[model samples]
Target chain A: MSLIAVVDYGMGNLRSVDKALEHVARDGQEVRITSSADEILAADRVVFPGQGAARDCMRELESRKLIEPVMQAAKEKPFLGICMGLQVLLAHSEENDGVDCMGLYPGNVRFFGKVLNQDDPAEPLKIPHMGWNNVNQTIDHPLWQGITDGSRFYFVHSYYVDPEERSIIAGETTYGIGFTSAIACDNVFAVQFHPEKSATDGLKLLENFTHWDGK
Target chain B: MSLAKRIIPCLDVDNGRVVKGVQFVDIRDAGDPVEVARRYDEEGADEITFLDITASSDNRDTIVHVVEHVAEEVFIPLTVGGGIRKIEDVRTMLNAGADKVAINTAAVFNPEFVKEATDRVGSQCIVVAIDAKQVSAEGEPLRWEIFTHGGRKPTGLDAVEWARKMVDYGAGEILLTSMDRDGTKIGFDIPLTHAIAEAVSVPVIASGGVGNLEHLAEGIIDGMADAVLAASIFHFGEFTVHEAKQHMAKRGIEVRL
Candidate 1:
């Protein structure tokens, strides 16, 4: 039996994330939502999920002492980051001035403040970019299994990640401009959208993560 | 490809049972909230909204249980509305797995509550639901006023300006519903919706008076709304969420289908 730990550092609702993970977990696979460093490090697979400001997220992670365990999980275990979980993986973010993050990947989060859409050209896109958008897979990975290349996932955020390393970029999606939506590096797979709320394709992605061995 | 317009199915629940009424008159029971939510999820509904019509303090617990049951199976974003007064209410709904909470009358009574709720629980989960009634007609300056308590009491606040105020207070989204055309189902108040959608930088969800599929398209195309929400259209079996998405897709609107 393997235990999947979903890190809960006092951010937005992790209950739905935990419920979704448990819904797709197979026999002998258990999902637990914990902020404990030891429990996270002991888990076979780890999921880091969060939402809210980057600075606030960093503060909570530091106060809860989850920074080291999360970084360690990224390096060793099968780690999945969603929404702000993916943003905090970057080195710094421009949200609310500038906030330094976990530096799990060399990247920066940017705000899409009224950027003009390439498709529409005339009108400026909305700020929080909240809704369902298509994610075009850039590179092949186990997590992308069974999901179509241009499948749409539920996205709700004002900021998008700009990874410094080009090779780590796994998926790209267009909001105003083509922005990095998902990233993958060895054991770590992170996405800017909420797969827990993305309906069918989302459930499929979670099911794949549950069975994924991080190969 | 552009971002797909959302088709949301709003379930009006009264004391834990899913019910849809016309103009708050002749209310009829639809089905169990969980069962109906699950059907919509399977039918490719982008999101589901549970608006507690009862809004009674005692029934608040019932709404929480309803949200818990729906969130357990329906894996899409679930927005719970009605009677969300304070931060504790936000925490209660979020803990029960509701992705967002819609704040109405409280926002009109105490605007700072929106700011505080958004401050404590991020702007993404706080949705300010506005019930608007057009105070003017054609051949004149367009004006709409905010109405509270199911559009029975007028707050004398301008609809467009009120929307901007809520957004400035850190509301992530606006669920704008028109009381004038709510049960009429002729269509959305396009002018009112357009004005609010253009005024705010945040996404506006055009709601109420969605009679047919064409009305849904009008919300996104004409009204410039990011999403369209309706109750009777889906609750009464007039159209399924899948059919609505298909119709919207045929109209060249980007949809997940």
Candidate 2:
């Protein structure tokens, strides 16, 4: 089994995802979190986990000289983006420093400013959308393999993804309204929810990613 | 869409060292500020603040050096304060790669300094940090007196009123630290936080008195703070950033996972 590389850009949650990958992968399958571009390119699978703003995360990648390598890896290997990681895969984000992103997927990440009710609010559904919420898989994809519909996973973000192509959506979750919760196009797969914090169901999703053979 | 509650880690640094001391105790030693900062960045900290605790603002060069190192090493936004006196000081810090420069003593000493710095650096880059202590009486004004020089001197300025003036002068954000609970770990000063939050249209970051995850959650949910800042809990490794986010999520505070 080829080792999985978790890209480290000096910003984001690196350890929990590393541990979660270890927890799900079969014996002898290894996962390493690295900032080295060479290791990222050599790996069979790459997981880009981000915990900061979209622009800052991209700046870190550029500062480390890993943008080209990461973009190339997205094309060559099975790539996964978690949380803000998923958002940066798009053409651009509204929260960006007015810079273009990796453009691995054809979509734009935007804040849900229109949906926020002026009155009678559910006090908890404030910005950062941090918590465990259920997702309904909208498209058939291997990343969601063995995971059923309405399965709760961890989500923490203020922005939502709206793909230019509706066919790319793999899952949907409801906050103030149902938005695209996950995306898959070709070899690229991304989820707005955090599988690392999704508990048993999350581990199962990781297992599916480890064994997926689809192109 | 609800605004995302940010998870920020604060570092109290003195003489190029990270130290945690209450009003009257031997300061507990922490490790290198850079190394600790790197770890937090990797663990997914939304932002980091470096508060220089020493009294003097003379070592502007040293502050620049620290900012350069942190910028080269860490990816998230860095906010540094303590002894920042003038627009030139703000320029020096920002040129050294600090995303935001916080001001306390200078803002209190010369209220116009806040306006001048904000104009020079742009309102978004200028942050007015306030240290407050709650008053004793009821039916009287519930005043939050501003403290300066690392909580050593009282400015005779009401925190709420100061906050209003700072906003009027074009400050984009406020960093409010409570001296009464600076090292107590009891919890954040919620009433004070709400008052300030209510008083200002700009974002308010509640600093001091965060002992555990519950304190952080309460600061955001009940206190209405835009962000919660703490030093001991994060510095001593009481909880990982991920664990805190998990706890906050459980309590219904929006966090980045």
Candidate 3:
């Protein structure tokens, strides 16, 4: 039996993510939401998800003693990150002034800034870029098995990830400027959008994660 | 690709069942809110809004149950509103799998509650619902006035001014509904929606009075709404979400399709 642990450090809505995973979990598969190190370490896979400011997220992870287990899990197993989960995996984030994050991925999370484009200053880019937007698949990976390119994914964040290595970028999206929407390197895969809230394509991604062999 | 304009279907739920009414009266049962939401999800609805119209303490659990059921099957953003009076109510809805909570009466009564709720949950998940009615007093320029308690009580606050204030207080989005155009089905109140959308930097969802696919387009094109939210046009089989998206797309509007 495969057990997937959804890391819970008391941030973001874990219920919806857990329920979405459970809906896609197949035979001999189980999903658990836990902050317990043992549960996370023993699990076959891990899904790190979060919302709110990066500073507060990092603080909560440190307070709950989840920083080590989460870092270790990302290194050891097939890992998936969503939203804040993706941002925190980077070296640092511009949210809450600035916050240091786990250095698993070489990148810096940057704010979208006040203006989308300085040259064409028509619409002042809205912060927390909310709603559905298309994600352009950048590379062919097992995780992109059933989902098509240019499929719309739900995103709600003021900041976006700028990976140091562009090769690891699995998907790119535009919301004023083209930004890294998803990244992949070895067994670690993360997306800026909320697949759990992305409907069909999202469910398919979660289902693929369950069957992925961490290649 | 440009950011796709959203098409949201709103379900007014009571006792776990989806209901629809004109101006909060002449109510009729639509179906189970969860079932309706699931169908909309399958039909490619950009988002879903489940408003608990009952507003009774006893029905709180039922609303939560409905939200849970919808969230379980529908893997899309869900915004739950109606009777959200406090921080606890917002917490309850978000905990039940709702991505956002819309506050109307509570925000009008206690404006500080908007700031406090946004501070606690982040503005991205806090939506301020403004029910506005066009008021033109003799000798004064026409302006939209904010209304509360399902548009029954009017507040002196200007709709555009209140929208700007809500954004300043940390509201991420504004759900603007026009009382005069709500159930009339003629179209959205473009001027009122345009006023609020232009006033606030955040996205504004134009709700109420969607008669056809063209009306939905007008909400986005004419009214400049970030999203168009409808009820009867979708719930009563007048149009599917796909059709509306197609119409919008043909009109050169960016949509998911």
Once superposed on the true structure, which residue ranges of model 3 sit more than 4 Å away at CA? A115-121, B21-30, B137-140
Error of 1 at A78 (Å): 0.6
Score candidate 1 by DockQ. 0.87
Every candidate's TM-score, chain A alone? 0.96, 0.93, 0.96
lDDT of 2 by residue, B1-257 (tens): 23346777887777676677312122232346667777776776777888877656565466677776776556556789987887887877776667678988888889898888765545666789888997658888678888865688776788899899998987768898889888898999999998888787667889888988999999988888877887777666668787888898899876656
> How high is the lDDT of residue A200 in model 1?
79
Compared to the true structure, candidate 1 yields what TM-score? 0.96
lDDT of 2 by residue, A123-145 (tens): 42344454456788887788787
Q: For residues B25-127, what per-residue lDDT tens digits would candidate 1 score against the true structure?
A: 2233246888778777877889899888785677669998999988999899999998888789999999999988999999999999999999999999999
Tell me the tens digit of each residue's lDDT in model 3 across A56-91.
899999998999999998888899999999999999
DockQ of each model vs. true complex? 0.87, 0.05, 0.81
TM-scores, one per candidate: 0.96, 0.57, 0.95
Q: What's the candidate order when arranged by decreasing TM-score?
A: 1, 3, 2
Regions of candidate 1 where Cα sits further than 4 Å from its true position: A114-122, B21-30
Checking candidate 1 for backbone clashes, the offending pairs are none
